[model samples]
Target: MTMADDTDRYGRVSRVLHWGMALLILWQFLSAGAHFLLGDTAVEEFFWATHKPLGLLLFVLIFVRVLWALMNVSRRPQSVNAAAKAGHIALYMLLVIVPGLALLRQYGSGKSFEPFGIPLFSGFEGDETPWMVAPGDLLHSWLGWVLLAIILGHIFMVVWHRRSASQPDVLPRMWR
Candidate 1:
């Protein structure tokens, strides 16, 4: 029950953020899936409404998690291998980039954003910023799906590593 990350396993705060983000990401994918697979139906409508607010929430959570991760970097367990380390870095990058691009697009589109009524964006008076909107429109959904694929790969690697020839189960570090 450590409160900070140690060399052997993640601490309570890290575990909490890791698992919390997992659930949130799962919900986000569900929302995306509904939007992609169900389109204009009631299910899509229901899920889509939550997507924006949830994305903002995930963004904030990730920001905090990154700061926490930085604080605990020296104390965290070593990566099992280069691949594991790269995968982790990629995951973090995509987590930030996907939502980051979306928010950028939101602001650039000159549409007011007040998720949970916080007034994040104040809206503009002319045409949308094509640059911001373009990158987001081009990469957001695509990269989002890629992120999902990477996450699936991450899950597989976690389980696969549990049976690795050289180490203990990696799952326990984050899960237990």
Candidate 2:
């Protein structure tokens, strides 16, 4: 198999990042769902604990994915149209923004954060940084759901394109 993307299909690394992020996003949503719908339960406890660390993981993965995409841009398969291209751009933006806001809030909370024992932030003394905390508090969950909606739309577009006679079956670019 090819290690780099071609005009017709994604390379191994691209496919791994794409699908890997997809799965992580799905798990993130599940954690959020449990927190929301199954509050104060073991299910929520199990899933919610992973939310922050996984969000941090995703934040890092997205940057790597973005750089990879940029590096492979010229050789990658073409987007179906302006809308498809725009949709992808939107996806990438949300992927960055959602976790970014959360990380901001985390730093603002005046608490140490050591995801997977990496020691990302050491707690600071004095009052918490409200400015940093506020944006993430206000937008993190909201943008996350928005991200979910957009992802669903993306999946729909893919399926629609595959089933429709007018468009190409684009899944093979990443899947096959």
**Residue by residue across 12-72, what tens digits does model 2's lDDT show?**
9999999999999999999999999999999999999999999999999999999998999
Task: Supply the TM-score for candidate 2.
Answer: 0.98
- Report lDDT (Cα) of residue 62, candidate 2: 92
Scored against the true structure, residue 142 in model 1 reaches a CA lDDT of 97
What TM-score number comes out for model 1? Answer: 0.96
Cα deviation of 175 in candidate 1 (Å)? 1.3
**Each model's RMSD to truth, in Å?**
1.1, 0.8
Task: Please write out the lDDT profile of model 1 over residues 109-143, one tens digit for every residue.
Answer: 99999998899879989999999999999999999
Clashes of each: 0, 0
Task: Give residue 97's error in model 2 in angstroms.
Answer: 0.6
TM-score of every model versus the real structure: 0.96, 0.98
